[model samples]
Target chain A: MPSADEIFAGLMQGAREEAAELWEEAKEFSINTCWSLASQLVLVGQAFVAGEFTKAEVTKYLETIRLQFIATLAAALMKVEGLAERIVNAALTAVRDAINGALGFKLIV
Target chain B: MLRAIVVLLVVLVVSGCSSFQLGERYDKSLDDDLSAFQIEAVTFVASMRLNSGTPAGAFTSDAAKAFYPKASGTLSNIVVKAGLLSSRQCPINGIANSIGLPTIKIGGETIAADTPKTVVTGNCAVVTLLALQNVLADLEASHRDHQKIGPIRGQLAIDDINKAVATTLSGLRAKDL
Candidate 1:
């Protein structure tokens, strides 16, 4: 039978790899969104200065962009938070199961 | 017509500048929340370490004795880094102030103006907390299965561990706000 320690070691190794992958994904999404928002803002500013857009039109455009940026940020943050919670819960359950399997005692959380 | 163009230019520049400032403020707020979560994590890990005192006798299996301390140390280091990231002042705050930009000190050491650092730090805390919980679980299990190995002094109760984990997890969630 594999020792409880060995089981935990293996589980944690897997958990770390998973966490790193999630982090990288979030990072990429954030960078892309920031760049896109900046580009859109610059284009809007250029149009406003060129008199192509009225002040009211520029205001509406900026507001829309702002709202979109906020939404994207909120979604990304939620995804990362959810991932963290899942990782923690999964680790606890895995350890509990490994120990129970090894010792044959029902371990209650 | 020229006057109107200049007026439009000023409006555009001011509005654009203000929007960026607002974004920076939002990012700072998020960073502050992440720092708070990091502190909470550190406290929880410290409590776990305190509860896991050296037992009177050796563990029954060589693996138990070898892995327990190693896992504990690894968890401790992760918590420390998270704490540092939270408590230190962001290097960007000062630079932003000098450049006439609105500056908010979101306490943390991260690449300048990077909000993803907060998410990364929070995830790191989660990973460490989970690993610590696993180690504690393994120790408790080993103690239960091997009576001859004797008791681990100050060994944490399962209830206490569960409670701490719950608290830490909630704190991490709260940081999303």
Candidate 2:
């Protein structure tokens, strides 16, 4: 039978891999959102330079876009943070379960 | 090995089971309402794009001006509905200890330290809806000022609204897990 230390090390390794994957997902989401928002802004800048929008209209539109991006970014970050918390809790639970199973009793509670 | 297990349990007990959180129970009604709104919003923007150069679809035209009040009213209803859901549903609690409460800031204003998680988890839907409202208003203003929304700007607005709604819906769905 595998010893408790060895079982724990293995479970923790799995947990670390899981956490890293989640982190990578979060990073990618933020990057993509930034890219999308920047692209829209570039379009606005181009239109402004082309004399399509007056200065006041451009300024107002930019402010509105800023607010829109802020809310979207905030919600995205919240989703990431919430998922990370859940992953941590799950990892701990897995370790506890593995330890208990190895000892043939409720060893960790 | 036994000693290590004991130490791990101690750490777990100290940390608490699910005290660290920023999520609430999944509300299906919230999901339905937002999804419905998304269709309505995108469809409206698409219509505006199609009719950009027509006098009948002009922002200042009587027909176009009539849609604003109805759209704004629907959004206001959504904001209220989401607020009720967030306030009513509580996140599951495994252990009653909070380790790190992250301070959150949006648009340069810091949310209150004590309620950051709850606000983010609960009020995030409301916040996003409110932001969408602003976007709608901006669209209205742009249409009025410019006399019509060009196809490019119309598509951009649709894309923006779609993304915002998708992110919030996904977040709300995640809370179920």
- On lDDT, the leading prediction is 2
Q: Report the C-alpha lDDT of model 1 over A1-109, residue by residue, as the tens digit.
A: 2333443455455545666867565555544544453444344444334443334433333323332333333334434555654554454455555655777886433
The alpha-carbon deviation from the true structure for residue B83 of candidate 2, after best TM-score superposition, in angstroms, is 1.9
Docking class of 1: incorrect
In angstroms, how far off is B52's CA in candidate 2?
1.6
Model 2 RMSD, rounded to 1 decimal: 13.9
* Alpha-carbon shift of residue A50 in model 1 (angstroms): 8.2
Give the CA lDDT, 0 to 100, for residue B168 in model 1.
41
Candidate 1 segments exceeding 4 Å error: A1-30, A45-52, A105-109, B1-177
Model 2 alpha-carbon miss at residue A27, Å = 4.4
Task: State residue B2's C-alpha deviation in candidate 1, in Å.
Answer: 67
Residue-level lDDT of model 2, residues B1-177, one tens digit each, is 977855765477445553335544457887888888889878877887788789866887775777788778877887787676555322311111132332222234333333222222335566555457767877887788888777767766787778777766776776665
Model 2 Cα lDDT, one tens digit per residue, A51-99 = 4445555555644454454556546655765687677567677766776
- CA lDDT, every prediction? 0.38, 0.61
